[model samples]
Target: MRCEEGPLSEVYDRLRAEIVDGTLAPGAALVETTLAERYGTSRTPVREALRRLQQDGLVERADRGMRVRTRSPEEILEIYEARIALEATAAAGAAQRRSDFDLVRISRAQKTMTATPASDPAAMAESNRAVHEAIWAASHNGTIVDLLTRLNNHLTRYPWTTLSMPGRWEEAIVEHAEIIDAIEKRDSDRAYELAREHMTKARELRLRIYGDDATA
Candidate 1:
């Protein structure tokens, strides 16, 4: 059966994208009237969008209306730790269970991420997310996909992307390629090792961005 979506879904998608790309930053006010005016729609869709955002952990109710959810530095670090553990497991599963279609989709996502034209930071961030999600889907495990998606949505609360750091994007391209190769070869043990190493190095890079305060 075909799914039917209305204005509410469109509004939700736009708002969610903005939130993920840091356009609607953490703690930014989300008044229905203002959003409706901006989107040139009515309050109904705005309200609906806010509701979905709350469900997605991107926003929270406030006394005035709602606002983008914010996380403390410590909370963000803890969340990354969770992501590292979960994603490594997912990668191992993908190596074991991935189909031909899954491999093709992941390769396409990798190309999108490493586009020769060099996309802007926001586009690059979304591309990075796409690759990770492709791997998650390739695992053929619904539970891990759901867990990783939620963690990633929370991750977007950070204003800066680890991929934007100098040399980081190039480094990630090589790392991702290795991960994909391991999965393609159906080397589950190697995939698990590469996944942990990838995330651990990424965490270290991100911590460097946060500097002394986060590393502590």
Candidate 2:
């Protein structure tokens, strides 16, 4: 069946992208009328988008109405911990079961991402997500992939502009290369450890950005 991208879905996707990329800062209000006007749609679609955002944990209902959700340092750490568990397991499974076609696809995606200029944060984020999803799919575990997909949506809610910083993008490319190598070697343990370590570094970067400040 061909999935429909209705007005509501369009608004949802746009708002979600903005939220993920930090265009919509944490704690910023999402006024339905303003969004409706901006998107050239009715308030109905905007409301629907807000509802979907809430479901995705990107936005929350506040006393003044809808506001972008903010991640506390503790919460960010917890989320990364959860990611390590889920993604490490998935990477291990992928190492065990990945097909040659899967490896090729993953290699291509990573190459495209690494080739992209570091100055393009938007493109980098898109390609980074693509490579990760490809690896997740290689595992051939539907349930695990679905869970990671949902978690990733929540994870993106936090501003991760660190990837745009000097050297970090290169670091990420190298880390991805290591992950691909481990999977290609069919070393499940190594793949799992690399995945966990990669996320741990990501968590550290986020902590540096958000800091221990509770108000941040």
List, in order, the clash count of every candidate structure: 0, 0
| lDDT by residue (tens digit), candidate 2, 125-203 | 8888888898999999999898888787787876565687568899999999999999999999999999999878887
Least well predicted 10-residue stretch by lDDT in candidate 2: 1-10
Candidate 2 wrongly placed segments (more than 4 Å): 1-6, 21-24, 31-40, 212-216
RMSD of each: 4.9, 4.4
My TM-score estimates for the predictions, one after another, are: 0.79, 0.83
lDDT of 1 by residue, 158-189 (tens): 66678877888898899999999999999999
Top candidate by lDDT: 2
**Model 1, 65: alpha-carbon shift in Å?**
4.1
